[model samples]
Target: MIKLANYTQGQWQEGTGPGTTLYDPVLGTALASVDAGGLDMAACYDWARTQGGTALRALSYAERAALLKQIGQVLQDNRDKYYDISLQNSGTVQNDTAVDVDGAIYTLSYYAKLGGKLPAHVHLEGESQGLARDNAFASQHIEVPARGVALLINAFNFPSWGLWEKAAPALLSGVPIVVKPASATAWLTHEMVKDVIEANILPAGALSIVCGRPEGLLDALNALDMVSFTGSADTAASLRGHRRIQHDGVRFNAETDSVNSALLGPDDSDAAADLLVREVVRELTIKSGQKCTAIRRIFVPESRYEAIAGAIAAKLKTITVGDPRKPEVRMGSLVSRQQHEAILAGIAQLSHHCEILFNGSTEITIQAEAGSACVAPMLFGAKDPDTNPLVHQVEVFGPVATLMPYRDTEHAFELVRRGMGSLVASVYSEDPQFMAQAAIRLAESHGRVHLVNTEVAKVQTGHGNAMPQSNHGGPGRAGGGEELGGLRALKFYHRTAAIQASPDILNRLIQNAE
Candidate 1:
């Protein structure tokens, strides 16, 4: 079996404790073993703060962007090898794996674009007063790199893109990175990290990885350190409120799974309905509905409840469940047995609040099949929104969606808002006026809104996933944190300080560059 090791301090380090066995979902056989026992968290932090940060700061913004482009090119050169490893990580098809593998490279490429487009200098100038007392002060703003380490805690789904989104900005900002990928599919991330090391794109100690758990890792952080996490609200809360993190004033940013919803416009034609069905089905089956941004609740007119579910259910039925490497397969298995159990448990919680409409329960009959865990599409019908608030409160992280109906457009927006806060909400409409009204009303409650219809539907990223260019988080129970909004991510990596003084003092400070 292939053994997984941690990449730290410019070398691969062996684990000190028990190892976790990695497997293939299609074959149910051992592929590798990852050891993550006795990692030196303190030393890891020291290396990033010193060696990593120093090298990155030496380069200018344009120079840094150039390095990122080189890294992207290197990733493209070895894309096939990364895709090969992605196939075994519960990805049921090549398209699914390619999105994760290539999407990461694209994210870095986008960062290079951002660096070239954004202004290098920000000038804060005071307005000139009347005649002889024409006193004006000039303050030049310089976008400098954060002089510390960045700690990234990513989710299991989209492991490659999840970590790459954060790494691109951190490195570009002249900060080093120490990543902690989700344990479920750390091997794939490990492989990608190996390529990053071999390419010599990043300086030694600029990027590091710890495959498994690193206990007491946060305690060693300093004021300049940053923490970016993407996961569930419960886990986010525990990490965001850590004793050491709070005491040391370490920055923390989180993107938690929320009750993301989608809507069908009032003037939507039959074509709109058909488009909605396709989008919904894609959200439910892609990554087995394991995405944090997956549509958990769907809002529609009371008259079209059965029609929407029936159309979507048919598409779900056609999805093939087998090895992700097979070209014929459209959907893949969940990441692991433990994740399968968690999704089922979440489904049970929803069942208590809503009735099952379409049960996608089936056993795998393909080769190397292990029937120990299997989940097909599950559609829940929540007829009444007021009867139980739990329907909007809980989420079944699988190929499932709860269909909720409303009397009119106003009622639809209200029901959508009742989910507390969400990461995203989408409305499909051919009418521009209706789309405008719905988007304006729902925009406050959701971090993202896809005002999609036949016009932009062809290129839509769909309703269930967040791209690296946009913010992928929400407010309230949806964790009320943000991540991946271009350079907004850098806000979490560095500390912002405001200095109040005369122009001469500021000039002296800038001129005395130590």
Candidate 2:
């Protein structure tokens, strides 16, 4: 069994408390145990602020991005090992692991790309003003990294990608990072962080990890400390209201799960409709539909409800469920029995509010190995998109999607908005006008909206997923916050101030800023 270690101040340390067992999703068998208790939280914070922050800020954006690229490459080279460790966390097949581990490495490469495209200064370009006859001054702006620490509180799903998506930008913008991965899957992140350390890709004190509960850590934070949290809305609200954070104006960003939705193209042919059905089943079965961006609500025209339901149900029936490693299995198990229970509870809630169209009937047909818990993809039907109460209010967080029928494009927009706010909402249409109208209105409520049709559907990102380049999180029930939108995320770790000064003075200030 491989034991996970925490990277603190450039050193690897063993814990004093007993470890928790990490398991394989297939049979719920123990793969490894990771220790999480008896670490000095205060020291961890101080080390980050003093050593990590200072050292990181000393490097330029290009320099920091370079280090990140190295880390990304190193991880890419060792992805096989990463895939092995990832399967232990469950719902992780080869493709899923590639997206999680390799995707993070790619995130660094993207950041490096972003650095070249954006400005080097802290402010953006402002309107030009005339200084004198034949003499004019233009105000170009730039963003500076916050002279503080970035507390990255990541989710259990997509642990590596989630942490890297934020950490890459935070580091590029010159902020030290203190990562707190979800306790359920910290080991994978730990392994990646270890590879980074072994490769000597980052300066000492630039990164640190906390393996367990971060009790009282937020209370000790200063104004310079900023936090980026990805998880439940309730938990994000609680963290945002921490006494010191609220009073001292600490930066806070949250990416919470919500009822993400997708709309089918009205003019799509039977073949196009078949593609959409397959897409739905793929999203529903991948990671056992545990992704936060996964489509929880699907909208179709009322006239086509039966056709859509039949097409989707047929594909859902074909999904294989079992160990992710099995070549025949298309979907893996949920992370744990506790997570399975939560998914079942959410499904029960949906049943109370909506009619069950597809109950993942096929998932039960597959025999579960001893001690394993599993659920096949389930699809529900809500006949009226505008009137269905359960469609927007409930999200099973499993491979379940509620089909809601709309009267027209306007009604589709209304149903999409019924989610209140979402991390993402997808539209499938070929007409430019329809796509534009649906997307514009949906954008008002959704953080990221993907317009998918025949041309883009083949290469289209599925309905329920947010990439590193796009903003994740939305207003209201989707945690009412945002994270990882390129350089925008860097601002989460920085403090901005407006300055009025002459060229010489501004130049002097810029030179001394870091």
User: Weakest 10 consecutive residues, lDDT, candidate 2?
Assistant: 133-142
Instruction: Provide the lDDT at 225 for model 2.
Output: 82
RMSD of 1: 3.1
Candidate 1's TM-score: 0.92
- TM agreement with the true structure for every prediction: 0.92, 0.92
Per-residue lDDT, model 1, residue 61, is 61
Name the TM-score of candidate 2. Answer: 0.92
Off by over 4 Å in 1: 118-143, 362-368, 499-514
* Candidate 1 residue pairs that clash: 92-324, 93-324
User: Looking at candidate 1, what is the lDDT of residue 484?
Assistant: 70
User: Candidate 2: misplaced stretches above 4 Å?
Assistant: 1-3, 116-142, 268-272, 362-364, 385-387, 507-514
